[model samples]
Target: MKYVQLGNSGLIVSKLAFGAMTFGYGNIPSVYKVGQDQSQELVDRALAAGINFFDTADAYADGQSEEMLGRLLGARRKETVIATKAGNRMGPGLVQSGLSRKHLFDACDASLARLNTDYIDLYIVHKTDPFTPLEETLGALNDLVRQGKARYIGYSNWPAWMAAQAVQIQHERRWATFINGQMYYSLVGRDIEHDTVPFMNNCGVGLTVWSPLAGGFLSGKYTRDNLSDPNNRLSGFDFLPLDKEWGFTVLDAVREIAQNHSATPAQVSLAWLLSQSHVCSVLVGSSKPSQLDDNLSAVDLQLTSEETAKLNELTRPVPLYPNWFTTMTLDGRVVEALK
Candidate 1:
């Protein structure tokens, strides 16, 4: 697998990171219930395929996800870059969640214990806590780095403005700044491009994309004819919303490209994300090894400039107010002035 530096950080991670959200067996709603044995087999296959980055979260399966991932990696822990998230509700109490100092410290220790590791390669805040001050959350994350509990810090599911503010705060305080931002991004969902991608690119923060397949809608299993597959995750969990009309248009383009490359539509979808220069890694989770293998092949599926442009044109987001106004005002006029 190809390795790249995570944002401005010195740590290098595999472009295709294995997500362990599917590693637990439980009645958790919308979660894939794979047992330890199958999870181990999948992990082994990923490692054998050269994936060195693993992502998990304490909120997944009520923390069982991390435990299963830890057990599976076993002795190969040193060779992997393990990432986990906190700040989600882990229990019934109010104190059980949020990015407050108490919860972060408690959650970090719990994650470390469950993962059987001394330090987390990357510790991310799972979501924004409007109730808690951003300074408190960032300060706690900084302390984790200073204490050697977490090597680097990041945040997930945060608005672009908040993420940019956090980076500025950390710089001002001389604290550990975030090196990455994890968010839902895919061909069907190009919303992040409006702000998050631009902010991250300007601030030197890398992006780790989750739901690159739009939660399985772009997996080729779903089509205009076969819209509802009872066994599909999207049928039950449908997440990271997309405009179905436009989504199908993008899917058509992906299908054409997939046929040309002799690749699965899923691989084509993933390759599209990998083609973005700012994307550091794309997280792929699977209940079976075959699915993992298909995703791994995306790294080798090269899309030509024309094919890439076709997909881009089909799904590109419509320019919103200020952006459209700015483009209208400056784009042509600047060239005229230069002439």
Candidate 2:
């Protein structure tokens, strides 16, 4: 249960961030049917397992998820890091969401009220709003920090260039910058490797990976044999669209390592992410305590270099365009190997 610094900030968060996305609305439209009692049990289990960071979104179950987590962790509020997002519709009104100052502040306050907390550990801009100027959005966020409403800021589901631009704007204006980035990154979704990963590495910003399992694709619970099960979470939601043929290749490799470690395939999948140096935290969300336990145990599963090498070989994507050109053009430009 190791803790890593959040970007360049002083706060040290756990290696796994419990995601509250699954806390509410089981399979309903926008609002899944998750009860409070069940939600509390899951929250208690996560904290008991040494998870210190939790993530939720304003739009999740129409904010019911935040409300539940707030009630669950409100007493020991200072002990954990609570992260939630803005830029999603809070209601039918046009002003209820987005990155504009109106929506940002309103959304933050609404989230705070629901979570039953005064300050948010990490407040993230859920997405980029081309309609709103970056200056306006960040200026409002900086105001939140100044007001002690939020300790740190972050971004999610944003492009590499947009993230870099926000950091630069903050620097020039001397405003608070986003020290962390929360986005979809995993063995199956390596698109960030080319852009987002490099930007975070160079800027000293941290990466909090969401959907690291590609919405349960890497869990090994989904196969041609069980795809039609009505109880399966991924049955209707085939989210984040995976390349099945390619995904199975990674799955086959994961099974081999899981067998070697005497662990489940899901544990091997998460271990693969934890083994990466750039990942500060991987978010895990579940509807059952058993599921959470499986994810928690992944922290202890260590894949040897040989095992990792094999998995990488099976899942690595073919380099595209400019990246290929650069590697080819720069090959052998410098000579020398040493210790």
Output the worst ten-in-a-row residue range by lDDT, candidate 2: 330-339
What would the per-residue lDDT of candidate 2 be over residues 44-72, giving only the tens digit for each residue?
A: 99899889999998888888889888989
Q: Which regions in candidate 2 have their CA more than 4 angstroms from the true location?
A: 26-33, 331-339
What pairs collide in candidate 2?
25-32, 25-33, 26-32, 26-33
> lDDT tens digits, residues 1-339, model 1?
999999998989999999998777666445658888899899999999999999999988888999999999999999999999999888889899999999999999999999999999999999999999999999999999999999999999999999989999999999999999999999888888888999999998999999889888899888776667666566678756677777887788899899999999999999999999989999999988889999999999999999999888888889988888877788787788999
- Every model's TM-score: 0.96, 0.96
Task: Please list the Cα RMSD from the true structure of every candidate, rounded to 1 decimal place.
Answer: 1.6, 1.7
TM-score of 2: 0.96
Candidate 2: C-alpha RMSD after superposition:
1.7
